[model samples]
Structures are given as structure tokens and as C-alpha cells.
Target: MYKSNAFCRKILCGVAFAATVFSTPTFAANDYPNKPIRILVGASAGGGTDILARALAEKFSQALKQTVVVENRPGASQTIAADNTARANPDGYTLLAATNTNQAIAPHILKLSYDPLKDINAVGLIAKVPHVLVVGKNSPYKSVQDVVNAMKADPGKLTYGSSGIGSTQHIAGEAFNLATGAKATHVPYKGSSQAHADIISGEVSMMFDTTSSAMSQIRGGTLRPLAVLSPERSPELPDVPTLAESGIKGADMYTWYGLFVTGGTDPKIVELLNKTLNDALATPDIQQRLKSLGGEITPMSAADLAKLNKEEFERFGKLAKEANLQAQ
Candidate 1:
């Protein structure tokens, strides 16, 4: 009778432990964000990604009634920040402000310490910004065809600038070469600002710059807009034609921004973050701010963001393979 009672006690203890273990996540999710939350950005503060991150952080803090912070890690094409986030505890506190460059493009070219799709759980998608093909204000190439004609005529004499090799801008330039059957020498810069300066001064022929990065110069009349590298024209630059409209096909591209937490995060926490993000995005002030920066607000569920990330990863992988792009 003593032995049987002891065995029964052991069984009961095991069940209680299991229940506690299983219920811990629910309890944590319910009391989530009790402490400060941090969003890691892969780019330096003041860049387009950082700007959006700060904006979203403000919204998240207000919605969750917690202190949310944007921390910039800024290297290896945003992978440093991503890897850090992936390795963080699966609580909802540490989040990654991810872009296509890190989530989709970098994995194809750079050796990464984390699996973007697997090591990180998608929280939600925030916005997308299309690349704008631009040239120096005083350039002779007036349009996409003019640039194509120049490239074909010189057979690699024309050169283009980008943030860096294996960057979205570089891939867009290479995609342009493949689609239009033109060749232009690629000149990679340390950052978009240097590339923009060079392009504006005619140091390079052109650049496929993100709309947010190029908008100020474009408005200042130092950089001339040629076409947008997206399926459709951007609302910010509605008068600008798409690459397809310019008779260039198979080269549509854009950079997207989203939120992510470490993999194995509880579904309840993910849902909470997703709802907060979508609600923040739906606000008028936030909408206007993001729009002014040339971003299209793209609120989506965590599952949908995951699906989109996978699709982008595969698509960019194919593009990288075809373009013979490798990190340099």
C-alpha cells in the first residue's frame, strides 16, 4: 500500500509539472511585455529602415503600454541584427525590424549565422518601398530606352551605382541587364548616400535607388527619375512609369519591411503583436508618415508574412543564381 501510494504521488507530480510547463506560455502571453521591448534594426539610425522602425516602435509602445525601443545594429546587410534577434529568448520582447535585403536577398549571397525563415517567427509585415531608376539631373539619357541604348552602344561603358554588391540595388541593376539585353559596369558603394552623391555628380551613369532614399534628391532636382522597379507605378511617383511600361520585362523588384521574433515564440504572443502592428498601421497619422516616405502600408497576418517571406526568398534565390551574384 505504501509503494502504491508513492507511485500515485509520483504520477500526480508529473502531471502537475506538465500542466505548469504547458500553461507557462499562456500565462506569459497574457502578461506579455511587462518589461521594455526592443526592436533591432540592421541599418544605422536615420535610414529608411530605421525611420520606419522608430515609427512602429512608437506605435507599439502606445498600444502595449510598454516602453519599446529601436536599436540599430547596422552591418552585414542587416543580418547582424537578425541573427541577434533569432538567438534571443522566445519571449516577445526582442523583435527584429527586417527588410527584404536581410530576410530574402542576403541569405542568397552572404553566409549567415541564422536561418531567416526558420530561426525567426514572422510577427507581421509593415510596408514596401519600390526602387526608382534615377540618373543625374543633367544626364543625356532621358529615359530607360535612352539608357538601354547607351549601354548597348558602348557595351559596358555605361556604369551604375548601388549601395553594395549583392544589395537590392545591385540585383535590380543586374536584372535590368538581363531583361533589356544591355550591359553596364556595376560600381558598389559603402552606403546609399555615397552612391547617390556619385550618381548626382555623374560619377556613375545611374542607380536603382529606393524611393525613400531617392525622393529628396529627386525633389531637389539633383536626381532625375526614370522609372520605378515595381509591378505598378508608386503612388509617390505616379507619373513615373514602371519598368514594364518602359518595355523592360522580368525585372520587377521592391524592398519590404516587417517585424519578427525568435522562432518558437508562442502563437498567442505572435497574434498579439500582429494585431497591434496592424492596428497601428491602420491609423491615419502613421499611414501618412509612411506614405510620405514612399512606403505603401502593407499590414498582413503573421502567417501571410511568413508565406510572403518564403516566396521572396525563393524568387531572390533564382535571381541571384541567374545573375551570378555573390557577396564581395
Candidate 2:
């Protein structure tokens, strides 16, 4: 009887241990996101990146049934925010609204504290927006070809403004120069608003601005859409031709946004986040809202986004080397 009692106690203990071992992951998965989630953005309020972050945050909150907040760090060309997210706890509570400017371009041109490709795991691609080549309404140039011609006619005389030295706009301008042999002087601004102000005031010649950022000015008639820096024309500016259409091949530039967490995040958590984000993006409301902002909802799997992140990282590294781009 004593031996039987001892055996029964051991069996009970073993069963309990096995139950915990099997149930922990399931419990964690279901109980995740019990707290608020924060998404870090590296741009000031009212900027294109900030706008996208906020919009997504709201949808994420709705889908996850928890509060989603966007915290703006707004400096260091977005590396500040990227680094913060990279160092955050490897839980699903913290995320970063990763952009090509921070993930791809800044790594190439800036001295980063963390590796964009290795330090973070991409949850999924959120959206992509094409850059629009625009000039002041009263400017003499009418099209991308016109600007290129001016640059060729008097190299280094024409000037272009960008959000910063290593921004997507800067890359577009430099890529344009490489493709069309135009030498336009570059002027970096603290933000796109300042750049747009200079362009409107005629202090700068042109800018390769995001469609969403340039939308107000374009509608206000302060900026004229010359050609989109995309392979295809934007629906928002149907009249504007593509750079390729203007004979500038291989100059297509689009800023892509992704969701990310620290690299060591559990695969199950990453899968859940990807599913939630992709589902939110698929909703009609999210689709319409992003479309209105000149963004194409291109929801991709986490694996695909990881592949893209690495490719862009390598591609921009090569570009930076060829252009001799240095951290400022």
C-alpha cells in the first residue's frame, strides 16, 4: 500500500509537469498582447512616415484588441528609432515602423549602432509609395526631361532638395545623375516640409518628394508634378509620366515601409504579428485609406520581407560605395 501511494504521487507530479510543458506556448500565444504595443517612428509629426505609422497603429490596435501607440523619436535619419526597436525586448509589445530610409539607405550612409538586417526580424511589408519629381509652379522646367536637359546644359547649376543627405530623395537624385548624366547640386533639409518650402520659394530647383508629402503642395499649385520616380504613373497624378517614360531607365525609386521587432523574437510570435498585420491591411477601410495617401498596399509574408530587406541592404551598400557616400 505504501509503495502504491508513492507511485501514484509520482504519476500525478509527472502529469502536471507534462501539462505545463505542453500548455505554456499555447497560453503565451493566446495571452500575448495583453498590454499596449508601441510603434516607434523616426520622423516628426505630420511627415509621411509619421502619418503612415499613425494610420497603421490605429488599425493594429483594432485588430489586436489592445492599444497601439506610435512614439515619434524623429532624428538621426530614422536610425534613432530603428536602433531603439532593435534593442527593445524581443516580445511583441514593441515594434518599429521600418522604412527604406532607415533600414536600407541610412545603414549605407550612417554609422549605425545595430545591423538593420541582422538585428531585427521583419514582420511584413506594410506599404510602398512612389516619389514624385516636382518643381515650383512658376519654375521654367515642365518635365523630368526638361530638368535633365537643364542639368546637361549647365551641370551643377540646378539644385535639388531632399529631406536629408542620405534620404530616399537623395538616392533618387544621385541615381538620376548616374542614369541620365546630369549633375544637379544637392541641398539637404531637416525635413520634407522645409525642403518643400524652399522648393516653393524658389530657393531650390526641384525635389524627388513622396506623393503623400507632395500631395498638398501639388494640389495647392505651389508644386508642379513633373514625372513620378516610379515604373508606372501614380493614380493620384495620372498625367505625370514615369522617369522611364522620359528616357531615364533604371531610375525607379519607391520608399517601402515594413513592420519589425528585435531579431530574436519567437517564430510563433512573428507569425502571429504577420498574420494580424496582413489581415488588417487587407481590410477595405485600410486599403482605401492607404490608397488615398498614394500608397499601394503590398502586404508580404515575413520571409519575403526578410529577403527584400537583405537585398536592399546589399544594393544600397553598393550604391553608397560607388557614390562615395559618407556618414554626416
Candidate 3:
């Protein structure tokens, strides 16, 4: 009788332990974000991602009633920050500032240690910024067709600058070539700063640069906006025409930024975060801040963001194959 009692006690203890372990997440979610949160960006300080991250951190701090920090882990095309976030505990504290380049294109250009789609869960989408095809203020190419005609006139004679060899700017340049049936040489720089410098000096012909990075120059009348590489016109540059409006199809591209947490995060915690983020995005102050920086607010639910992430992953595969981009 004692032996049977001992066995029953052991079974009860095992069940209790399992229940405690399974219920811990629920408990954590109930008191979600009691501590400070950190949002990691995969770029150096002062870059577009970092800038946006700081803005978001401020809003998140205000909304969550806890301190929020923006941490930069720039390297390997944003895989470093992503890997760090992926390895972090699936709690509500650590977050990743994910961009389409890191979440979508990097997987094709670089062999990542983690599966971006599987290792990170989408919390919400923040904004989308289109790349503008800009030339020096004095350039003779007044329109996208002018550049296309010039490229067809002398294939590979026109040179374009980008942030790097495998950057989204490079991808945009190549997509432009494929779409226009024109060949243009690619001149890559370490970052957009140097590329923009050269383009302004007429050392390079053009660059498909983000509206945020090119906003100052555009406003100063230093860069001529020929067309934006998005399906829709950017409100920041409402006067500029889209590639489609310019009669150039199939070169559509835009940079999107979103929020992410480690995969397997508690659903309740995720829901709380999504609510906080969507609320922050809806604030008039946040809206104005993002708009001033050339970002178009594209607030989306977590489920919708996840759906878009999957679609972008597949679309990038096609772009990689079409552009002959190989994994380095």
C-alpha cells in the first residue's frame, strides 16, 4: 500500500511540474512588460533604421509605461541584430526592428544562421519608404524615359551608385536595367552617404535611394527626383511620378520597416505588443514625425504583417533569380 502511494505521489508531482511550466507564460503575459524593453536595430547609429527605431522607442516607452531602448548591432547585412534577437528569450522585452532587406533579401544574398521567417515573429509593420530615382540637380536626364533611352543608347555605359554590392539599392538598379532592357554599370559604395556625395558631384549617374536618406537633398533641390520606385506616389514627394506613371513597369520596389520578437512568444504578450504598436502608430505626433522623415505610415495587424512577410520572402526569391543574384 505504501509503495502504491509513493508511485501516485510521484505521478502527481510530475503533473504539477508540467502545469507550472505551461502556466508560466500565461503568468508572464498577465504582467507583460513590467521591465524596460529593448528594440535592436541592425544598422549603425544615425542610419535610417536607427533613427526610426529611436522614434519608435520613445512612443513605445510612453505607451507601455516602461523604458524602451534602441540598440544597434550593425553587421552582415543586419543578420547580426536579427540573430541576436532570435536567440533572445521569447519574452516581451527584446524586440527587433526588422526591414525588408534584412527579413527578405538578406536570406537570398547571405546564408543566415537563422530562418528569418521562422525564427522571428512579426509584431507589426511600421512604415514603408519608396526609393526615388534621383539624379544630380544639373543632370540632363529629365525623366525616367530619358535615362532609359540613354542606357539603351550605350548599354553598360551609364554608371549608378549604391550602398553596397548586395544592397537593396543595387537590387533596385538591377531591376531597373531588367525592366527597361537597358544595361547600366553599378558603382557600389560602403554606404549611401558616399554614394550620395558622388552622385551629387556627377561621379555617378543616378541612385535609387530611400526617400528618407534623400529627403534633405530633395528638399534642398540638390537631387532631381525623376521617379519613385513604388506602385504609389510618395506623399513626401507628391510632385514626383511613380515608375509606372513614367511608363516603366516591373521595377516596383519599396523599403518597409516592421517590429518583431523572437518566435514562439506568448500569444497574449504578442497581442498586447501589437495593440501598443498600432496605437502608437495612430498618434498624430507619431504620424507627423514619420511623415516628416519621408516615411508613409503602413500600420498593419500582426497577422497581416506575417502574411506580407511570407509574400515578400517569395517575391524576393523571384527577384533574386531574375537579377542573377547569388548567395555570397
User: Which runs of model 2 end up more than 4 angstroms from their true locations?
Assistant: 1-29
Candidate 3 TM-score versus the reference? 0.88
In the predicted model 3, the residue pairs found to clash are: none
Q: lDDT of model 2 at residue 197?
A: 81
TM-score for each predicted model, relative to the true structure = 0.89, 0.87, 0.88
Please give the RMSD to the true structure for each candidate, in Å. 2.5, 4.2, 2.6
lDDT of each: 0.88, 0.86, 0.85
Ten-residue region with minimum lDDT total, candidate 3:
188-197
lDDT for each residue of candidate 1 in 200-295, tens digit (9 for 90 to 100): 788899999888678878888999999999898888888999999999998877888899999999999999999999999999998998887688
Top model by lDDT, which number?
A: 1
Evaluated at residue 70, the lDDT of candidate 3 is: 92
> Which sections of candidate 3 miss by over 4 Å?
136-142, 149-157, 163-167, 187-194, 201-204, 245-247
Better of 1 and 2 by TM-score: 1
Task: Rank by TM-score, highest first.
Answer: 1, 3, 2
